[model samples]
Target: MKRSLEFFPVQLFAVIMGLSGLTIAFAKAWHFLNINYFEAIYKVLLLLDTILFFVVFMTYIFKWIKYPEAVKKEFNHPVKSSFAAAISISFLLISIAYYDYAPSVSIIFWWVGAPLHLFFTYKVMKFWIEHKFEVGHINPAWFIPIVGNVLIPVVGVDAQPEMVNIFFYAIGIFFWLVLFTIVIYRMIFHNPLGKRLLPTFFILIAPPAVGFISYFRITFGLIDTDSLFLYFIALFIFVLLLTMFRQFIKLQFFISWWAYTFPMAALTIATILMDSAYDTNLTYYGALFLLAVTTLLVAYVTYKTFIAINNHKICIPEEE
Candidate 1:
């Protein structure tokens, strides 16, 4: 088999777009540190994230079309490829809606993309279970898109309609549970160490962390003063922090460190929103400290990521 430098462009494009989205997300969080600039920064970040999503999705689509068989063979299940295509199309539709001035296309894209993304998620989960892939390992590759879709309606775009919110949240929670089960399984069985541990730790903790926040926000207005949603949010937050501490001690630092920005930011926003309903001071402080530490870690990892990318070491070799 022959390898060429041509493979690097696609990977480079994906990484650049992904990191740009991360940078925007982190900027939004940094702005929140002052409170006064939060809304402005958030709006900017949301727009930037949407753009970044489009670029990354386009890159993936190109790769899918270019190397269909190769990509399909990477997964044990064939449905995974179709589901991935569905996700890319959904994101593309949504991104176009965000930029389009006409109401008809915007509404059409919104309606189409939302349901397709949910369906894609369902199929993906089904594939995971049927194939018996170790779901609990918490790798960043899977976690990022899950969290991104959940946030797209909440933070990256306008508030979704109540019906849409309920639909997405319900489907989102179901998929999240599947992901959670897999992560816990990996933690128990694999006991991942070294570099693998970093992405796995983030994948394990961040989904539930963000899911809890999104669920609370969606249910906040409709529910009563003493709703179960609040309790669920609190419980998930507790689990997230506990997992973070354990992973930190294990020294699974790079991906776990840099990846905290998006999750912690979402948690902080949720805490602020639920301040009146719950005692959120600890969550607030915890998110703040984690955000600070994650910034420093991301800076270091970023330098390393750049070197690795240039040297074509971004994709890890699968163990025998």
Candidate 2:
């Protein structure tokens, strides 16, 4: 326990991000399809997501109290620092989940999460400006901070004014493009990511996915050209990553494997929104397919994660 506490990582919060996303994805399914089964699963997931969030949040707090230096080191790490945003993103996602069940509580989380994420965005961008980084340091995880910004409008559309959410939406969309270019350059020209970090390639699907949803929220659920553009870009990346499944399957388990979950959830949710708009058989079945894939993917990763934890594979020192 001491060893685990000493090396406890901020990336653990990604679990909350993934679970929150899955919970929301199912909630959307229940809302649109009116499937009683999905509704039950959605409620159960909400309960479990709430509990998991507290567990991960409290554990990280303990780690911070006991190992402040370790926390600081990760906060300063070029690659790892981006993951710290997952903490705020978790808060934002949980806020989205609770919006229907409890608006007041949702607003509380939104208030806490939105500002904190902006702070992280500022800090991370400042770090980028202040430091000199090699191309090898770039990866899809760099999109995390921007993804959090895109997420604001999901719940913020209801919790706050339009301009506020739009403000965040603009920032997210612009930076996503910029960072997407840089990360793609690194992937094509530089060496491949380590097996452990390879799952982050799935993150390439998130910004546009979340952007599609946020655009829907901002436009009163209207499917426009821009929304279609965002959705198809996300869909293309989703297909692109699927073709690499053989490579991903061969890699050993790493906590970084959780990277596969939230982005899948984002695309799943976006597809569900698309179904809501089109009301076509193809969109409906497509959403269902992606939802099943997202759910099973998350379940498998969760199982592997627990196995790794039981075998004492997580929360130990790494080579960085």
The top-ranked prediction according to TM-score is: 2
* C-alpha positional error of residue 125 in candidate 1 after TM-score superposition, expressed in Å: 3.1
The 10-residue segment with the lowest total lDDT in model 2: 1-10
lDDT of 2 by residue, 45-156 (tens): 9999999999989999998898899899998998999999999999999999988678899989999999999999999999999999989999999999765799998889
Clashing residue pairs found in predicted model 1: 135-182, 136-182, 136-183, 138-200
Q: Which ten residues in a row have the lowest lDDT in candidate 1?
A: 5-14
TM-score versus the correct structure, for each prediction: 0.62, 0.98
* 1-320 per-residue lDDT for model 1 (tens digits): 23332231222332332333344334434443444554454455456556755665676567667766545654333322322433433343344323323345445555656556656556555664576544433444454334334533443234366676666555556656665565556657775544543533443444554455455556553334433454345447546656667556555323233343434434444444344344367745655555555445445656766665566554443222
TM-score for candidate 1, please give it. 0.62
Instruction: Estimate every model's Cα lDDT from 0 to 1.
Output: 0.46, 0.90
Highest lDDT model number: 2
